[model samples]
Target: MSIDSTRFILLNTSHYGNIGATARAMKTMGFSDLVLVAPRFADALVHEDTVAMASGAADILVRARVVGSLAEALDGISYACATAMTPRDFGPATHAPRPLFAELARSEHRVAFVFGSERFGMANDDVYRCHACISIPTHPDYGSLNLAQAVQLLAYDWRQALGGFEVAPRVPDASLADGAQVQGLLGHWQQALTDIGFLDPAAPKKLMPRLNQLLNRAELSAEEVHILRGIARAIQRRG
Candidate 1:
């Protein structure tokens, strides 16, 4: 029940925002201990950008421990879990985050969740040092997640396994975009395609409808719709 005993170790973190976001994610889930192993920026934890990105979780950043090596980070850890999506011929067996957290939740000993650099995940030796590997179940074609997102997912699952924390209710009736919004997105895509010469308006086949169907199936949220629209605008600008 003492989640504080579990540490969140970040190795060679290259981005200040990621470090800050990781702190926010850990604090949101009630986990505090953070260890950074030779981060790219020596003062990332205290950087203004990092503090800004941490939102209201700056306390975690203030108390974060920095070490010169992974060994130092794992000094007192009883069990360690490496968050690495890639498979290795040798090393700890990869387990999905939920089940792994469920098992770790029962342990009273100190535990650590180890994450690696954004460009490349944990080195083979580091992965080998862990008792287990945690891979968040993601689409096979696109399994890559940002460093902070990965931390958030694992933190959320681990927190849930530890009886979970209360979160505020979402706004009522605020969900994925409705039909009109989808259509608008499709229209934007159509113009973008035409502007980029990807689709010939005169000789257009069923491509637009097909794309519309694909978008509909995606159940895009309002934010996603806005992102797609922004992409379309970018395409138009470039065209």
Candidate 2:
């Protein structure tokens, strides 16, 4: 697999400093594809603060692509993973980036690891679009990680994976669902749950969240999402 096919996407990044730091982190790990999805500051890549933070890796900031949405950023990517600490009901299965990278290294398709804004992390909608979620192992009482720190960890893993690092004997045989497919499946389920009176949209407490967790653990593939959505449609019609 070409290491150049791997992308590091930052979504709704608010601080130019973080952007710069992220650039440096990626460069240190030999990753160059940097895409910023709707950063808070339009001039983040060129800002003085960003330049100052990037230090020696300003070349990455200069070449970074800025886009309007996550979908746009992930247009041609086959596998997309989200990095976040907050557990979700419908989120992808959480894995350490290292093993995930090792598996990804065997694939020829384009891949992306998306990180949310420093302030709020990724939105549920954005997280839903990813094929998997990565939670950096940390202390239970304090699991918060800086945006750049997270990038560095994943980038390092990808670099190692490219260099033939294997934590296990073999990667699993599975094709993961992309963002749009996952979103459609979730939408179908949401409607079905509403029709069945299983989810009160007005006061949706933990029902959908619980279901998200369940589905994420299932690691549904595209075919599986399609099948599940079919079942959801059936439930909608029956109700």
User: What clash count goes with each model?
Assistant: 0, 4
Q: Write the per-residue lDDT of candidate 1 for residues 1-239, one digit (tens) a residue.
A: 68688899999999999999999999989999999999999889999999999999999998999999898999988999998877899889989888877877887768899999998889999999999998889997888899999989888888899899776778765479989989999999999999999999999899988998898789899889999999999999999
Q: After superposition, how far is residue 92 of candidate 2 from its true place, in Å?
A: 1.6
lDDT (CA) per prediction: 0.91, 0.87
- Deviation in Å, model 2, residue 3 alpha carbon: 3.0
lDDT of 2 at 156: 81
Displacement of the residue 189 alpha carbon in candidate 1, Å = 49
User: Least accurate stretch of 10 residues (summed lDDT) in model 1?
Assistant: 165-174
Tens digit of per-residue lDDT, candidate 2, span 204-233: 888777877777888888889888988988
How many clashes in candidate 1? 0
- Superposed Cα deviation of residue 132, candidate 1 (Å): 0.3
On TM-score, the leading prediction is: 1
Error of 1 at 142 (Å): 0.5
